[model samples]
Target: MFARVVVTNMGNEMFNDGLFYTEQAELHKDQQFNKWRYCRSAIICFCVAAEAELAKLIAHSLRKQPHLSPEYTEILLFLTDPNSDKPIPKKLKNIRKKYNLLRRLNGLRPQKPDQRYMELTELRNKIIHYTFSSHEDVYAGTILDSTKIARDAVRDFIADLYSIVRETPPEWVNNNSSIDIQ
Candidate 1:
């Protein structure tokens, strides 16, 4: 089991719906083109939820696959600007990736689902930099639903990856808590 933690940063770019972010009221606002900062953190209650639900997934994997000596954690941090290099720490150099800059501005993901995870993971290179934008959503539309499509892709990928583990043996002290109804 390979465990990883990911943080989603919300950029502060005003949309037609309202400012980049305003409180929970804006998110639930009923409008024709309702908009909210489509980042990864949704703060609610005394608890919080990933605006993207991607964190829950990483935790779920840790619980289900203890055999791989799994110990992983993640933080879904929100950002005010895509190019806000100020908040980024020196130690967390891995945060810079080409694909991430794109995801922040437009919802366009990597060309292939397999490269999605690391597509935005390589932009920190001093010699080669990833591009960021402060424009309207170029990849908007039904395809902003790219995340949903990616979810389906992940489900299918995991199904195949874990098939052998499930078949390793039924009596090997099974633990099914690691998986959720994807």
Candidate 2:
């Protein structure tokens, strides 16, 4: 029997929402209106969703290992804050650190977040903390580029995990295509 892992759908939903916002922004731009506001928010939403999806994948994969199950449970508890007292942000940071450590122990190279992933994260932070005068100032093109990078990173990470779960390289790995959730 094949082991089944339930993947979260939130990432796909958020990505779709981001696309909708991008389309709206484009429409506004064509109509000679400011598009940056929506575009910036869209990118941030997409990044957040993608990160959630990636974290889910990592946690799911790690939990499958009998030896790591205990650690996985702790991480989940930290993330959920069942105690209702732990700072969620700090717990989230610790979870990311632990995830990286597990990735390294699993023999995956580039255990840390990918360069593009890190860049998108930083961009998301800047957008959230600072203000831009115009959509042009934020460089809509750059946001679009970061979106592609973020998507590719998620795809690659999923592909790698799928390969491990199947004990072989899945067809998507060779084809450079998205994994079919079925």
Candidate 3:
């Protein structure tokens, strides 16, 4: 008898959404209208997809360690969250913490988040916490550049995680090719 496994669709769906936003940003990269919007959205979606996938990986790893006591498991689940008073189910960890936990669970060596991950995270934060006044230039090309960085970051992040887990990444991660944005 073969073991049957069922997985949720949200992680992939979010990744695909990021791809869609990337496409939109590319299509409008040369235009002034909505290009910044699309680029910003693409960066945000990519970051979200990366975080969602990491969370899913941690959750799956948690499932494999059935020997852990319920209290210990809860502690592991919320390890990144500082507020211990919060309900276990409601606590959430930031992406870097989640990655660290995943590494610890797999007996991997500890390291800081890599450059690609930091670059993507910074891009996501820059756009997400938008300010009204800034000396930074606001243009379609500039925003599109950030979008491309985000696209590569998420792809690399996913590939690296899959490699750590000894699993093959999905087709989309490898299939991304540069298309003419104009």
- Count of backbone collisions within predicted model 1: 8
Better of 1 and 3 by lDDT: 3
Clashing pairs in 1: 10-79, 12-80, 40-51, 64-178, 96-123, 97-120, 97-122, 97-123
Question: Cα lDDT of all candidates, in order?
Answer: 0.26, 0.55, 0.68
**On residues 1-182, what C-alpha lDDT tens digit does candidate 2 reach at each position?**
89988875766656655656666666676443346665676667667655665566556665566675554566655544547564443334733464464465466653565566566666777777666654343565555556445545545654544443445423332332233345
Against the true structure, what is each candidate's TM-score? 0.25, 0.61, 0.75
The candidate that wins on lDDT is 3
lDDT, residue 77, model 1: 25
* Residue 146 in model 1: lDDT: 33
Clashing pairs in 2: none
Error of 3 at 83 (Å): 18
> How well does model 3 score by local distance difference test?
0.68
Better of 1 and 2 by lDDT: 2
Q: Model 3, range 33-124, lDDT digits (tens) per residue?
A: 67877877777777877777777677666677757666547855664455656574422445566677677667787567668877778767
Ranking by lDDT: 3, 2, 1
Supply candidate 1's per-residue lDDT for 9.
23
lDDT of 2 at 119: 62
